[model samples]
Target: MNRTLVRLLQAPSIILLLLWMIIPLSMTIYFSTIRYNLLYPERSGFIGLDNYRFFWTDPSFFPALTNTLVLVGSVLLITVVLGLAISILIDRPFKGRGIARVMLISPFFIMPTVSALVWKNMLMDPNNGLFAAFANALGMQPIEWLQDMPLFSIIIMVSWQWTPFAILIFMTSLQSQDKEQQEAATLDGAGFWSQFYNLTLPHLARPISIVILIQMIFHLAVFAEIFVTTSGGPGVQSTNLTYLIYIQSQQAFDVGVASAGGVFAIILANIVAIFLIRAVGKTLTV
Candidate 1:
C-alpha cells in the first residue's frame, strides 16, 4: 500500500517529464521531415529526408563532427588525468586543505559564458592578454590564440572549467576508500606506485567512468564557449556539431536542416550514452 501510494504520487512528475521531452522531440521530428524555413515560412511543405541528406552532405558536417570528437576526447583525457592527480594530492590531510579544495572546485560553479569571456578577453586575447604579457616578459612572441589555434584554445578553456568537476567526483570517491587496505599495503613493503596502480586505480574505476559518461554528454553540446570565443571561426575551425546546427538554424534560417541536425545529434548522443553506460556497468560489476 505504501509503495502504491508513493508511485501514485510520482505519476504526475513522470507524466510531465515524458510530455516535456516528447513534445519538443515530436516537433523537431516533424520539422526535420518538412521544408521549413524561417524566412520563407509561407512555402513550407513536406520534403521527406531531403533535409537529412543535405545536412549529412554539407561541406561543414565532417569538420564539425571531427571537431566535436577531438574536443570531447581531449577534454575528457585532460580532466580525468588532472582531476585524479589533484584528488590524490589533497585526499590526505594537508595545510589549508579545506581552503585549497574550495579554491580548486570554484571554477565548476562559474557560468560557462563568463568563463569563456574571461578566457577570451583576459587570457587568450593575444594582444594585451595575460599570456601575451608573459610572453613579452620572456622575450617571446605572443601567438594569436583564437586566430592561430582556435580549437585548441576552446579545448583548454573547456578543460579548465570541467577539470574541477572531475576532481570533485574523484575526491568524494577517495573518501570512501579502505584506509586499512592502504595501511596493509604499506606494511607489506608496497611502494606508492604499486599501491596506486593496484589499489587506488581499481578503487577509482567507477568514479572515473561516471565522470567520463557525464562529461561526454555535455561535451557533445558545447556551444557558448565556441560562440563567445571564436564564433566557430576562423573559417569553421572550432565549429562542432552543436554550433553547426546553430549556424544552419540561426545564420541560414533553415529550420528543416537545423532540426535534421538536431535529430542526428540526438542519435549520436544516445549511441555514445549506450556504449559508455554498458562499459561502465561492466566495470562496476567487475
Candidate 2:
C-alpha cells in the first residue's frame, strides 16, 4: 500500500516530464515530414523525406557540420586542459586564494549573449578594442579576430566562459583526494610530474570524463555566442548546425528544411551522448 501510494505520487511528475519532451519532438517529426513553411502554408503537403533531402543538399550543411565538430572539440580540449591546470595551481594554499578563485570562476556566471557582446566590442574589435590597443602599444598589427578567424574567436569565448565550470568540478574533486598518498609520494622523492601522473591524474580521471560529457552536450548546441559575436558570418564560416537551422527557419523561412536539420541534430547529439556515456561508465568502473 505504501509503495503504491509512492508510485501514485511519482506518476504525475513522470507523465509531465514525458509530455514536455514528447510534445515538441512529435511536432518536429511531423513538421519534418511535411512542407509546412510559414511563408508558403498554401503549399503545405506531405513530402516524406523531401525535407531531409533538401537539408542535406543545402550548400551550407557540410560547412555547418564541420564547424560544429570543430567548435565542440576545440572548446572541450581547451576547457579540460586549462581547467585542470588552473585547478591544480589554485588547489595549493596561497595568499588571496579565495579572491583568485572567485575571479576565475566568475566568467561562468555571465550570460552567453553578454559574454559574446563583450568579446566582440571590448576585446576583439580591431580598430579600437583592447587587442588593438595592446598591439599599438607593442608596435604590432592588430589582427581582425572575428573577421579573420570567426570560428576560432567563438571557440575562445566559449572556452573562457566554460573553463570555470570545469575548474569548479575539478577543484571539488581534488579536495576529496587522499592526501596520505601525496605525502607518501613526496617521501619517496617523486617529483611533481611523477606525482601528478601517478596520483593526481588517476584521481582526476572520473572528473575529467564528467566534465567532457557535460561540456560536449552543451557545446554541441552553442548558438548564442555565434549569433551575438559574428552572426555566423563572413559568409557562413562560423555557422554551426544550430545556427544553420536558424538560418533556414528565420532567414530563408523554410520550416520543413529547418525541421529536417533539427531532426538531424537530435540524432547527432544522441550518438555523441551515447559514446560519452559509455566512456564515462568505463571511467566509473575503473
Candidate 3:
C-alpha cells in the first residue's frame, strides 16, 4: 500500500515533466514539414524536407556549424588548462585564498546579458574601451576586437564566465589527492612536473572529462552572450548555429525554416553527446 501511494504521488510530477518537455518539441517537428512563414501566410503548403534543403543550402550554414565547434573547443580548452593551473595554485594553503577564490568565482555568477553588454560598451569599444585604452597606452594598435574578430570576442567572454566553474571542480578533485603519494615522489627527487604528469593528472582524468563534456553541452547552446555582443555579426562572421536559428525564427519570421534548423542542431548536439558517452564508457570506466 505504501509503495502504491508513493507511485501515485509521483505520477503527476512525471506527467507534468513529460508535457513540459514534449509540447514545444512536438510543435517544432510538425512545423518543420510544412512551409509556414509569417510573412507569406497565403502560400501555406506541405513542403516535406523543403525547409531542411533550404537551410542546408544556405551559405551561412556550414560556417555556423564550424563556428560552434571552434567556440566549444576553444572555450573548453581555455577552461581546463587555466582551471587546472589555478586549482593547483590555490590548493596550496595561502593567505587570503578564501577571498581570492570568491573573487574568481564571482564572474561566473554574473548574468550573461550583463557580462556581454559591459564587455561590448566598457571593454571592447575601439575608441575608449578599457582594452583599447590599455593597448594605446602601451603604444600598440587598438584592436577592434568585436568588429574584426566577432567570433573570437564571444569566445573570450564565454571563457571568462565559465573558467571558474572548471577551477572549482578541479580544486574539489584535488582535495582527494593522497598527500603521502606526493611526499613519496619528493623523496625520489621527482620534481613537481613529473609528479603532476604521472600522479595528479591521472587522478584528474575523470573530472577533466566530466568538465569537458558538461561545458561542451552548455556551450553548444550559448546564445545570450553572442546575441547581446555581436547581434550575429557585421556579417555572418559571429553567427553560430543557434544564432542562425534565431535569425530564421525572428528576423526572417520563417517558422518552418527555423524548426528545420533547430532539428539539425538537436541532431548535432545528440551526436556529440553520444560520442562523449561512448568515450567515457570505453576509457573512463572500470
Candidate 4:
C-alpha cells in the first residue's frame, strides 16, 4: 500500500475519536458560560461566571466535595490494603487457591449498574433485604442503610465491585517480585513481616501509586451505585460531584451548572494525575 494511503486510513480513526471526545467537551464549556436552562431556553444569555459563582456558593457543593473525597479516598484505602493482603496470600501455592482466585476476580466482571442494584435491593436494603431479614430475625431493627448511611453504602458497593480489579493489578505486580531477594532475606533471619515491609513493599511502590491514581480517577466518577441506590438522596447527603452534576443536568435541568461542575471534576482529576506522575518519576529514578 502507498504510504499516503496508509496514513490516510489511520487518520480517519484518530479524527473520529477526537471529534467524539472534543465535541461534547466543547459543548460543555460553551454551555457553562451561558445561562442555559431547559425550562426557559430562550432566556439563556452569556452569564459569564454567574453559574460558577452560584454553584460554588451553594451550601451543598462543599459537602458534596467532601463526600466525594471521602468516597474516593476510603475506597482507595480499603481496596489497596485488602488487595495487597489478598495478593500476598494467593501468591503462595495453597490448596483451592484457584477457586479462591476465581471468587475474588468475579466481582470485577459484574456490571456496575447490576452490582449497584443487587446491593441496593438485595444486600443493603433496610426493608426485606438480606441484612434487614437477618436483623429482623435477630430481633434487631433494620437500619436504613442507604438513607442513614448513603455515602458509606456507596463506598461498600463501589469497593465490592472494584476491589477485584485492585487485586488483579496487585497480583500482577506481586508476581514480578524478586523471589531471590525474598529467599536471601529469609536466609538472613529476616522474618516475614520485616521482609515484606522492606523488600516487597518497596518493590510495589510504583504499582501502588499507579493503582491509587487509576482507582482514584474511576472512583471519582462513581455514578451507578449512587444513582440506583440513593438517587443522590437523603437530602443530597450522598451526592458526590458526579451525582451532583447529574442531578443538576438531568433532574434540575441546569446545564450550565452541570458543565461548571464538570470543569471542576476535570481540574481535580488533573491535579491528582500531576501528583501521581511526579511521584512515579521520583520513585522510578530511585
Candidate 5:
C-alpha cells in the first residue's frame, strides 16, 4: 500500500516532465513535415520532406555547420588547456588565493549577452575601444575584429567565459586528488612537469571529460554572442547553426525550415553526446 502510494505520488511529476519535453519536440517534428510559414499561413499545408530538403540545400547550411564545429572544437581546446593551467596554478596555498579564485571564476557567472556586449563595445570596437586605444598608443592601426575576424572573436569571447567553468571543475577535482601520490612523486625527484604529467593529469581525466561534454552541449547552441557582437554577418561569416536557424524562423518567417534545422541540431547534439559518452566510459575504465 505504501509503495503504491509512492508510485502514485511520482507519476504526476514524471508525466509533466515528459509532456514538457515531448510537446515542443512533437510540434517541431509536425511543423517540419508541413508547409508552415508565419508569412503565409493561408498557404500552409502538408509538404512532406520539403522543409528538410530546402534546409539541407541552403547555401549557408554547410558554412553554418562548419562554423558550429569549429567554434565547439576551438573553445573546447582553449578552455580545457587554459583551465587546467589556471586551476593548477591557483591550487597551491598562497596569499590572497581565495580572492584570486573568486575573481578568476567570476567570468563564468556573467550573462552571455552581457559578456558579448562588453567584448563588442569595450574591447573589440575598432575605435574608442580598449584594443583600438592600445593600438593607437603604439602607433599601429586597430584591426576590425568583428568585420575581419568575426568567428575568431566569438571563439575568444566564448573561451573567456567558459574557461572559468572548466577551472571551477578542475579545481574541485584537484582538491580530491591523492596528495600522498603527489608527495611521493616530489620526494622521488619528480619535477613540476613530471608530477603534472604522471600524477595530476591522470587524476583530472574524468573532470576533463565532463567539462568537454557539458561545454560541447552548450557551445553547439551558441547564439547570443554571435547575435550581439557580429549579427552573424559580414555575410554569414560568423553564422553558426543556431543563428542560421534564427534567420530562417525569425527573419525569413520560415517555420518549416527552422523546425527542420532544429531537428538537425538535435541529431548533431545527440551524435556528439553519444561519442563523448563512449569516450568518458573509456576514461572511467582506465
Candidate 6:
C-alpha cells in the first residue's frame, strides 16, 4: 500500500514530464513532414522529406554545421582548461578567497542576452569600448570584434559565462579529494607538476568528464550570444545550426524547413550526448 501510494503521487509528475517533452516534439515532427509556410498557409500539403532535402542542400548548411562544431569545441576547450587552472589555484586558502569565488561564479548567473549585449557594446565596440580604449592606449588600432571576428567574439562571451560553472564543479570535486594521497606524494618529494599529473588529475578525471558532458549539451545549442552579437552576419561566417534554424523560422518563415532543421539538431545533440555519456561511464568505472 505504501509503494502504491508513492507511485500514485509520482504519477502526476511523470505524466507531466512526458507531455511537456512529447507535445512539442510531436508538433515539430509533424510540421517537418508537411509543406507549411506562414506566407502561404493555403498551399500547405503533405511534402514528406522535401523540407529535409532542401535544408540539407541549402548553401549555408555545411558552413553552419562547421561553425556549430567549432563554437562548441572552442568554448569547451577554453572553459575546461581555464576553469581547471582557476579552480586549482583557488583551492588553496588565500586572502579574500571567498569574495573572489563569489565574483568568479557571478557571471554564470547573468542572462545570455545581457552578457552578449555587454560584450558587444561595452567591451567589443571598436570606437569607444574598453578593448578599443586599451588598444588606443597601447598605440594600436582597435579591432572590430563582432564584425571581423564574429565567431571568436561569441566564443569569448560564452566561455566567460560558462567557465564559472566548470570552476564550481571542479572546486567541489577537489574538496573531496584524498588528502592522505597528497601528503604521501609530498613526503616523497613529488613536485607541483608531478603531484598534479599523478594525483590531482586522476582525482579530477570524473569531474572533468561531467563538466564536459554538461557543457557539451548546452554549448551545442548556443544561439543567443550569436544572435545578439552578430546576428550570424558578415555572410554566414558565424552562423551555427541553431541560428540557422532561427533564420529559417523567423526570417524566412518556413515552418517545415525550420522543423526539419530542428529535427537535425535534436539528432545531433542526441548523438553527442550518447557518446559523452559512454565515455564518462568508461572513465567512472575505471
User: By how many angstroms RMSD does model 4 differ from the true structure?
Assistant: 2.9
lDDT values for all models:
0.96, 0.94, 0.92, 0.89, 0.95, 0.94
The alpha-carbon deviation from the true structure for residue 218 of candidate 5, after best TM-score superposition, in angstroms, is 0.3
C-alpha TM-scores of all predictions = 0.94, 0.95, 0.94, 0.91, 0.94, 0.94
lDDT tens digits, residue span 31-98, model 5 = 99999899998988899999999999999999999999999999999999999999999988999999
Output the number of the lDDT-best candidate: 1
> In model 6, how large is the Cα lDDT of residue 277?
78
Q: Which 10-residue window of candidate 6 scores lowest in summed lDDT?
A: 277-286
Model 2 CA RMSD to the hidden true structure, in angstroms = 2.3
Per-residue lDDT of 155-238 in model 1, one digit per residue for the tens?
999999999999999999999999999999999999999999999999999889889999999999999999999999999899
Q: Please, what are the lDDT tens digits per residue for candidate 6 over residues 129-221?
A: 999999999999999998899999999999999999999999999999998889899999999999999999999988888888888899989
| lDDT by residue for model 3 (14-94), tens | 999999879988989889999899999997889999999999999999989899999999999999999999999988888
lDDT (Cα) of model 5: 0.95
Q: Which regions of candidate 4 deviate over 4 angstroms?
A: 1-6, 136-139, 275-286
Give me the overall lDDT of model 1. Answer: 0.96
- Model 1, residue 96: distance off in Å is 0.3
Candidate 4 accuracy as lDDT:
0.89
Task: Report backbone clashes per prediction.
Answer: 0, 0, 0, 0, 0, 0
The candidate, 1 or 6, that scores higher on lDDT is 1
